[model samples]
Target: MILRLALGLFAALALALFVQPQAARAAYPCPGGPGPGEVQVGVSGGSHGVAAVPICDRAQGGGGGGGSEVYYRYGSIAWHPDADDVWMEGSYDGPNTAERTALAACNQAMGGGCTSIGEWHNSSMRIFRDRSGALWSGWHGDGGVHSKKTLADCSAKQLLPCEVLGTYSSSKNRHLPKPTARKLYAVGAWVEGTEGFDSRLYIASGQRDAATAERLALDACTKATRQRCAILAFVGNGVIQTYRLGTGDQSATVESNAKRAAQAAQANCKKRGQACTLQRVYDSRTPGEFVHDFMAPAAK
Candidate 1:
């Protein structure tokens, strides 16, 4: 009996070896359960097959063989854990569909309350929601079109970075917000004692002295004039000149004596006036800028 059984097993094994074997499994199907673009048609089998299932591309290990992650592909984009689903959907393949999906996600996430969607942006979607829970779509684009004042959405609310970068300023203006600083020459001139004249005008980096202002003041007025004074204060775009009108057509004499008279006047002012009182010269130009005192109480 034992010999017969052994012979029978050998015959079966020989028969199996003669038949053609099945091909090995290839790459796992497009994640979610071997669908269209899948390598092997039906579900995987045995040790060579996929074991543990995935949760929306996330794997849950099981059995002796570790389970493989199942990724969901929307067009060319693939999403995984820790990735922004809304952004992925919005940025994938086509703009119309992806952007629409992204908008829906954002609107749903934010409570659907404010203004409607304004415009679609590269990485951002603008949905306007008011306190009343109304939702308006396509209001702001990615760079943020609408200027939102407060933070809140109606039905479904989504919180975004609080960076105002839209066409409105404080939700009141329609034009784009003004820039904080503009690249401009800001060309401005003031005679001696004028605008920035606390005697702290800097000629260049690391070079500053009160005498610079005094010198400028002395040469501000026209030559050959009775004026023999320095500019005490000049602001905006204007000039100042002082007069020491001597007796008669000192016009000719004044021009000739300008250098000497100016020197004398400056020296006299420094000696007679504490802090060197520089005289004020009259000006005719209108002011364009003004001095703003922002010093603290102690300094004031």
Candidate 2:
């Protein structure tokens, strides 16, 4: 009887050991199996494949054959006087690192003074332009709040003529492309503050041609002050200078050559006995080209 009892116990123990679930033998087993942001995918032969999954939380992590790892993502937008751009980054190792990375990328591509337009983790962003020519951007994890916030913010800023451009999701797309480069024309106008008049300054940019830009600037100035505004500068393919005389007389002369534009402006101002201080210069070229020609140093 004693021998039979010992044999039965031994048989049961062998069966239990052989049929144990593979999950019980996992290399890095959590007490509650896989936690949030984790999924157990079954591989062939009944082995549990640990994988990281996208979670609503800002920080996300996953498990794989090698081990567990964390991921970070961010999105951003930047704008200047005439253009704007967006950026996204992921696979970072620290908190808020993605925000800095995105900002750096945006500033590098769009030049300095770029703002931190938006940031997110496992989320996306969209931008809009209002009829009044204001720009707005918003971001959200699940794509619900962004639209509402974008419109609300634009309204808060009193931006009219608003329309959504599109949405960009890191989960669905790679990086957003750069804004299109184009030749730009601009106009600058300034009204002198006289005893009965308030001083005014107005600028219009990104016009297709110099004439159109000048017209727009003048119209804007007249609408704002109800007084005639003289064009201070015109830019297209080169820079031009405009000046106002002390006698309340304004003169506009276009020079095809940018090199002589400033000199010509000063000469005109001097001939009219003006201080030559009311002259303004404007550039009519793509921002990139303008930076290269003026901001960058001459080749040795």
Candidate 3:
């Protein structure tokens, strides 16, 4: 069993890691499952009775019982355990490109819900859904039975029986929901005081893009001051801190958390012999908006 697993994993890495596989013109059909282009399929290995092994093409000959002809293919699943089912279905096969592309699409799908999540690479992804409708993904190198082992692992953790969602190859964006067309975030402000220096910051989070985020922020500021609002800064998903110095300079920082950003900004201000006051703090996990007055309490 160990030898078989090692062989299969070797095949998966060969197909996915070394040279990029020739791009398929389109998805092909399979009878019972998701078809060649969809769920999974492979070559040479088919003669040996391997289903989704990607044909051992990347490595030197002599594997999967092959001596001369060699071919293997790789796959990646854009699976984030914390992601919603609708958000985790987008992915492709490139080694470095998979995670980045997946996150771009899924982040759009979930509206910046992936801030705290991480990513991964895998040759095969086994999807399982428990009776309660919670979805789980299992990953291993790649082989016909390799996917099965991962599926078993996934099933073991479930409180009930799981339904297999099929093993797939290459890039599969089939199930990703359309992005809400919402921008992630935007920050802006408009003047209001007699000196026209009201430093209050307004924000618009979860817009479709930077332009949208800024527009939303400015619009809110306009509503509040009944004047044209200018863009302060474009801050995205993270620990957002807005601050004002005694010198009347307004700035914001993006850090790991509210306190870190506040402290860093205050430290920077203190170096210049200026008073630093915290205007607002926004949650790093939140994909939403936050607003501020001209000034707020100092950081505790």
Candidate 4:
């Protein structure tokens, strides 16, 4: 149980980073501006960590995914690794929001004058900090090259006692797709009840199977800031929907579109004559490949 608790705490920390679109880093995303995609929810004030953080571990699935590209060009990061080791990280759709979220989160965690950040599209970013508190950033379209550059950056600066602060892939980050592959959609979250992007709610589409789709979405949720991830649902076609049942159970559904999905969720909760709320709905509009699942070509 102790071991499980420890691991849960670790995952919580990861979730914090994964969903931190509310952190401090701003000026770094890029002069180019925010890219394509949608942010379902926003985060508010507070310092969050594992102890009281929101998360739920209900399920899993599998796949081997490596590398990411921001062909969507939408992720912006807010980061401040102050020389005193006071730092925080968050993500956003553009520089302004990224900076706002990062600063809010960072100040809450530990007061600092954090004012640095970077931006990447579907690509990756890595940071290395030295004992002196000096920091270097590495960016590349390729995750592997970006990683190597991070280490080389410390070397170039001759910054000893250097260590990696964190690594990031933009919001749409995912592996390159196969031409003839089944498309799947999946949803996951750190905490079960809270919905939208702030809860580390994430979706992965166009996977090979239910396992792969769930794995991708869960993996993305884990890497981003959130509570703890639970696999909400998977489907081969239609849309993915999440909700809070009248009994308070967290669940999801696959419908043909956004309106139908929301209506279906509402109806399900209504069956109990209890309170229910439609949390999130990812229809054809959500972005990414919307196509594989346990339900096969469609949901039953």
* Residue 265, candidate 3: alpha-carbon lDDT: 70
Model 4 reaches what TM-score against the true structure?
0.29
lDDT of 1 by residue, 74-180 (tens): 21111111111212242232224533454454444444421112112222323232211112222222122111212221112211121221222111211211221
Best by lDDT: 3
How big is the positional error of residue 25 in model 3, measured in Å on the Cα after superposition? 33
Q: Please report, in order, the local distance difference test score of every candidate based on alpha carbons.
A: 0.22, 0.41, 0.43, 0.39
What's model 3's lDDT at 236?
A: 35
Show the lowest summed lDDT stretch of 10 residues, model 4: 1-10
lDDT of 3 by residue, 146-225 (tens): 34543444345322234564544334554553333122444544553334444566766544355666677777887777
lDDT of candidate 3 at residue 93, scale 0 to 100: 41
By TM-score, highest first, what's the ranking?
2, 3, 4, 1
Candidate number that wins on lDDT, 2 or 4? 2
> For residues 232-270, what per-residue lDDT tens digits would candidate 4 score against the true structure?
554433466665544545456654456666765666667
Of candidates 3 and 1, the better by lDDT: 3
- Sort the candidates on lDDT, descending order: 3, 2, 4, 1
Estimate TM-scores for all models.
0.16, 0.38, 0.37, 0.29
Better of 1 and 4 by TM-score: 4
Give the backbone clash total of model 3: 16
For candidate 4, the per-residue lDDT at 73 reads 32
